[model samples]
Target: MIWIAIRMLTGDRQKYYGLIFGIAFSTLLITQQLTIFVNLVERGASGTYNVPNADVWVMDGVSRTTDVNYPMPSTALDRVRSVPGVEWAVPHLRASASVRSGDGDLEGVSIIGVDDATLIGLPRNMVEGSADVLSQPDSVIIDDVGVTRLFEDGRSPIGERLELNDQRAVIRGIADAVPGFTSQVTLYTKYSQALRYVPGTRNRLSFVLVGAADNVSADELARRIHEQTGLRARTRDQFARDGIEFIVRNTGIPLNFGITVGLGFIVGVAIVGLTFSLFIRDNIKQFGALKAIGVTNAKIRAMVSAQAGLVGFTGYGLGVIGTMLFIWGFSANPFFKGFYIPWQIPLVSLAAVMLILALTGWLALRNVLKTEPASVFR
Candidate 1:
């Protein structure tokens, strides 16, 4: 009986191909849009996540995110270090500055200053040079993405001189850092070097990154710091969430992506419902003939289910393959770098496909079930 149903579905190449394309296209749309959305919002937390050694981040009470922060007094670092649970606290500076490339092109760039002695905030990996290169006089490390933007000729950015805040910044190395949401060029330097690169104000410290002592929980240390210092304190995960929330509250990305995903759902339902209904209606005579031969409705249902299952699996597999190819192809492009399809997204898409098939299949089956066995003669 199942073989007969499979034959019936495959016999109509036009409708079968149409159904597969519809489901595949819909799945592609939903999965692709969601992937891009997730990666874009996550860029907000890239700064926090890049510094793997810091268990807690101390900032001004009003600071909302890593980029949108208020510079605290320099003494703020000392206050944080005074906390008992803090094993060590280092000052971190993040500020924006304009840079002049070799061709006199002006670009806005982010300046990140890590701990001088330990280089605690530097990225774990280096693309071209060692992290110790920042220790050189007037030295800085440009992010790999920034190297592409600043030096487009594929020449080595090493030893290239950039003008920042009327100071000479020599790119001594290339750091493999994640690009921020705006894709701004980022430069990493020692704390003192960054102060020189960025036009300084009285308060130079933007944040204090802390390491918790042995046996001390990050959450507990953060709590104690907040209580004693009267400054905002957040565990690493909490601060990352703050960054994401900042983007969500300020941007329209979520709404736009939500609409795109909803449209994918609608398209899938419309195409699948129409094609499935027509296919079932055209086979109504066949269904009646089987009923007349003593085949039960339960058997008929199993037949329809088998047909739906075949179409669903085939379409879903093609869609996922398409998505993987899309991500892999664009991985080299800076904007799409580090973008990945989260496992949960595929599961969600699968549930959507199942719901679409079940609803359309049930509606199409109603007409076949109501037809009397005598209808085979009509």
Candidate 2:
């Protein structure tokens, strides 16, 4: 039956060839776009600014991890220490402000401040400078990309002493991390520097980052801290999941943005279906001849299904190759610095596309089976 179906479809080379390529092209586009969108959302949520994998985190009264809009009073550190299973809690301040490059005018910067006591939250793998460089008063750290984006490769603005508010500061180091996947280049400074830059704020810290005792469970500790302080304390794992879910649900990503990609897939299926139907419709006489030879309706139906599957399957395979190339090339390009392609997404998404292709072939098969061989005799 499969061989018969293949022979029937290939009998008309001109008709199904264009349909084959069109379906393949559609698959390539939809798969690549969906892969990018999902990868971006996933990376953004837990990439950097991501909590270190540990027992628990101590933040302000806010329940959501990304909603660090309010300051976690510097005094929050002391209270976190008293909680059992807390090995240590690091304190830091984070906010955004404008930068004066001394080039022309001030630009925007997302300033993050951390203490020497616990810079664990950072990516820790130094691309340029040491984490401890931030220990010096008014000393700052910038990523290589950040420096280039902000001051044209640290030529003019970096290293030079500048005024951040009333306080004098110097760019001491360059670093990189995954925090805020698409966040602008930032200025990293000490807790004191952050205090000075963000004025009209309490001298207290914003949040306490707690590392739990190794022997004990983090969940128990998170529960304790949450109960005690009326503040939210989440483990690093929870934080990452919450972060991804937040972007997916609140940002209308999986529902709205993803639907467009889904439509692309449906269109691919339709194109393949129409192409098969066109050939079947055009060859009513051939089908009639097969029927006249005592071919069962079920066999004819299977033949139709096998033909659609053959074309769809061939197109789907080619689409996977093309989509992979696009994913790799686009992510590596300089223009897509903020965008990232995680390793897991492509493998999973490819599998999904294959399954969808099979389903699409099944759908188009129904139309093929409905063609009556007797129509050709009339």
Candidate 3:
């Protein structure tokens, strides 16, 4: 009996193909859009996450996100380090400055100053030279993304020189750091080097990246720092969340992507509902004939379920595959760098496909069940 239903469902190549296309297109739309949305918003936190050694970040009370932070007094670092349960603390500086490229082009760049002694806040991975190269006189490390932007002609930036804040800086290394929201050129230099590269300010310390002592939780350490120093302290995860929330609250990205996803759901329902209904209605006589034989309504329902299952599986599989291919193809592009399809998104899309099939299948089955066995004679 199940075999007969499978044959019937597949026999109508037109409706079968239509149903698959509907599900596939909807899944592709929802999955791909959501993936891009998530990666894009998360870019705001890339700076925080790139430094994996820091367990806590202490900044000015008014500082919200990494990019929008206000520099704290240099004493703030000492205060944070003095707190109990604080293992170690280092001063971090993030400031923007205009740089004169080798070709005399003026470009805005972000200057990140890591600890001069420990180099604690530098990115863990290096694409070119070792992190130690920062010790070279007037040396700075450019992020991989910045390399492409600063030297668009595919020239090696290792020995390139740039004038920053009227100070000459030589690129000595390439750090494999994630690009921030603005995709600005990022130059990593020692705390002392950054001081010269950026215009002098009374308070040049943007943040104090801290590591919690053994047996000390990051949350607890942050709380202690906040209470003792009267500074805003956030755990690494908490700060990352703040970055994402900042983007969500300030931008229309969430609303825009949400609309696209919602439209995908609606399109799935409309197309699958209409096609499934028509397919069932056209096969009503066949269903009536089976009922005339010894097949009960329960058996008929199972048959319809099998048909929906096949369509759902095939369509969902194809849709997910398509989405994977899209992401993989663009992986080399700077815009899509680090873009990945989270496991949960596919499951979410699967649930949506099932819901679409269930609703449409239920509506289509009602007519078949009510038809009399003699209706086949008409």
Please count the clashing residue pairs in each candidate, in the order shown. Answer: 0, 6, 0
Regions more than 4 Å wrong, model 3 = none
| Model 1, CA-based lDDT | 0.93
Stretches > 4 Å off in candidate 1: none
Pairing residues by index, what is the TM-score of model 1? 0.98
**What is the lDDT, from 0 to 100, of the residue 248 in candidate 1?**
84
Best by TM-score: 1
| lDDT for each residue of candidate 2 in 5-67, tens digit (9 for 90 to 100) | 788778789866866785677667766677667665765454324445445766776546443
What is the lDDT, from 0 to 100, of the residue 54 in candidate 2? Answer: 42
Evaluation by lDDT, superior candidate among 2 and 3? 3
C-alpha positional error of residue 154 in candidate 3 after TM-score superposition, expressed in Å: 1.5
Preferred candidate (TM-score higher): 2 or 3: 3
Q: What TM-score would you give candidate 2 relative to the actual structure? A: 0.84
Better of 1 and 2 by lDDT: 1
Ranking by TM-score: 1, 3, 2
Q: Report the poorest 10 consecutive residues by lDDT, candidate 1.
A: 192-201
- Residues 6-100, candidate 3, lDDT per residue (tens digit)? 99999999999999999999999999999999899999899898889999999999999999999988888888889999989999999999999
